[model samples]
Target: MSSCHKCWHCITKRTRKDATRIVDVKQTKELSSPGAVEVDSPIGLLASTTAAFLGRARRGPLNTPVFIENFSEFRDHFGGCWSGSMLADAVQQFFSHGGTNLYVVRIANNARGARIDLPGPNGPLVLEAAEPSSTEHVRAAVDYDGIEDEKGQYFNLTLQRLAPDSSIVLDQEIYRRLSCQSDNVLFVGSELARSQLAHVCNTVPAHRPDSTGAGYINQTEMGTDGSALSDYDLIGSPELGTGMFSLNKIEEFDLLYIAPSMTSCVPGPAAVLAAEIYCRRRGTMLILDPPETWMSTSDALEGFEEAGYAHPDVLSYFPRAMSSHSATREESIAIGGAIAGLLCKLDRQSGPWEDLDQQGFELSHDLLPALDIPASEAHRLVKGGLNVIVGQRPGHAMVCGSVTLAHGSQSGDQFTSLTTRRLCLSIKNAVDSVTRRTVFKLNTAAVKEHIVADVRKYMDELVNAGALKNDRFSVDCDTNQGEKRINCTRDITISLTFDPACSDETIKLNICQAKSDSEVASQYA
Candidate 1:
């Protein structure tokens, strides 16, 4: 009996040690290569260059996504990242609320702008703004006395983007000892290419412009902000990669926000649908601002019907949050940016699992819900899949509901839960990361078994961590016996199922009272 007890003890200890080793190995693998669960995604913003005025710099590739760090970068490339531009304002809101990463896509129409002249031995050299902005003003000076090389081809050049008064230099660049000759050491092309203010044009000048130190050279033509961006502008060309499609250049993003711009046009129905499709394809969520026309709940409902949006991947805030414009005291600005910022904050702190409603999130500026929605209207709005911003004061502002613009099944209460949808996305993304590794391998049972094992491992971890209800997930990768094998389609089909972790938003309390002792005695008798 003593020997048997000792043997049992040793076996139990060995099992425990083996379990710990397995757990340690799993954790180390997860840390070394962070799967979708560990990596936080960035948000993508597609708007007009007017939203990000980069002084004299021409806008980025018409449809390319430009990664920006903060308001300074937005201002450096687009102009003022905020101010009156709705897109800029939304970006500010996103950051204030707690978003860390931002990718900006600056769109323009008919890219044209001003040109400045410089003196060159070959002819007249022309300099143009790197980006198009009506507010941009460039002034250059030739330092005839500052020629560094004995070649006499080297001279100093200074450029500036000046204020309206021409006194304050908004931005400036200086190139010393540059030569017009292509063979020269500091060729003009290479030197001026580094200039953020302007670039040397390819055309050779017939004659050099005046080198007067008293006044600076000015631009010949001003740029236009162009007409309001159409759906095509927001949808962008997949081939050219301009507009929202530019986000494809990146591997993944957390959110897609398309706010109005100085152009005054919000995304139309077509643009909204395109954004939904793109978000769905990329595993990102869309944060849509309300149309200016949605002044009332009825208006919003009517518009929602017209748009016919029913995807679970899109969320729209209503009536547009309003705040005092930073530039102008009396004018009220849109609150879309503030809401985006708050959502980012929520995502960072809690991993997008909590409902953004009733958490007491506040907007940066003195922003409030645009309309005073009555109880009935607010209910109607939420039922129709529009999230509402509600609060009496600025700091008190709070998002009232967790909902999306999706209708029918997507509009169902279970599917309407943003937390549930976000969890679903996280699971899908994580599963994708694991299964993608199995691609291009032999289509044998061993491959399928390994795929299933990886998926089950992940799902098991989620269950242990309380992210899933139980070990009830199913992952089937059996493709060898089907038509796929016969046709050599190189197809691997994977099906997954699991119940997501959820929270109880509402609880009911039942109350009852017992009959008096005297009545109970009488009834018994």
Candidate 2:
């Protein structure tokens, strides 16, 4: 448990990253950064970057999940891990595209941690950063101010995590009244066990560490950021919680975009399959980027059909978005971030049921599609269940097509439209939220009625907001659908099946109450 004191600097030409005692350097008081929007259960990402700690720790008693609150805070901590890291660009694309509800998992190959050695009465005292990084500017200071220790064996320690290229502190922690003896009540080892910054590397010295904040101190040693990520790095072990599996920490996610593992606009086939299955398990959508082989419209169509890349819970966009590297050259980048953000904006501004077919749904950042698609090609791509970028004006482009990878389902074309899937997810989220609060109540007639009434009110709200058909949805609770009695005494479970607007098939969802243990709550009927 550490204090999250943020300064919220503008990050413009004149601002810096600082807050609290360290932020007094910049004197920033309020948060007014543009594109800093807030929403619940935002889009999740798997990024390759360096940090004080990327929150991708091994399973143990001291495991901490790094849940990002907003875009600005993400920039402050993961803005610059190493020189070539894409943490900033990926997040900025999401912002420019208008997505929220973010969770990040930092990955490394053979990374090493930064540490500092201090002078102690008996031996040397060592403290190391929680996560490995070559570019994280971290340091520590020791002070013995007003200690209640009668033997003068207590001292204060301050750890500061600075920006990648500046002196502005991004995170700072102060541990006071810590004793050097292992048997003491306030032992340094036990005190720093809950620290978010650094941990005691070795056993505490026999006596208190000397004061190093005033005089010259042996500063922290720089560690290596290791090499680029591999395919297995992204699809980490499910049990250990690495790579895409790290998302187990987040309860609910609306959209997911897996950044490139090897090169631009591509992840391994095995990784894509793993992510699709994982997204299905979590009851969400995966925004896939075009494979490197799809350089043109005809190629994309042929490649998408030939490859076994069709799933109801997975959606994709075509060609790529041309990002300006300079005034002269523009490189083709994947549209996963932009497409995810556009969907997020659509889900918020319009209803999740509303697709970005028309009505001024535009992509920001002077972006243009990589290949020009004629009307005939666009129609064919839409039939193949892939979206496209159209209207290549200079400053921006339009998200013209909205289709899911699902060509057709057994019940008809309900999952064909991306909006239909989103609408169903929104309803699922609403049910889970309401049922969680009602789960602990006794099972009575009034309680069951109250549950049904709450769900119906939610469905009606979606209808009022132009998200659902007028009379196409229904809710059933505490009743047996099959032989099983809809049984749950200590747990809460709700089974639902409804039709989306202008859809032929019914959407079936069996959502269990969300728990903090990363339990599988949603299943297909």
The per-model lDDT (C-alpha) reads 0.58, 0.61
CA RMSD of each candidate after superposition:
19.1, 9.6
Candidate 1 local lDDT, residue 452: 67
TM-score of each: 0.69, 0.77
Model 1 C-alpha lDDT per residue in residues 1-525, reported as the tens digit of each score: 011211111111110011111111011122233222222222111111111111112333344456665666655556554333456666666666666666666776556545876645565678877666666677777765544445466555667776644567766665655666676656667667756567777664433344547567777666555555677777778777667766656654667777676423467788888888777766677877666656678998888877787777887767666653343323344555555666666665655556776555665446766677887888898889888777756577778777776567543556576777766666555555344333334435665676667766776876775666666667666543443322332445556667666644321111111112211100000
User: Which candidate leads in TM-score?
Assistant: 2
TM-score of 1: 0.69
> Which pairs of residues collide in candidate 2?
19-23, 42-100, 42-101
Backbone clashes, each candidate:
21, 3
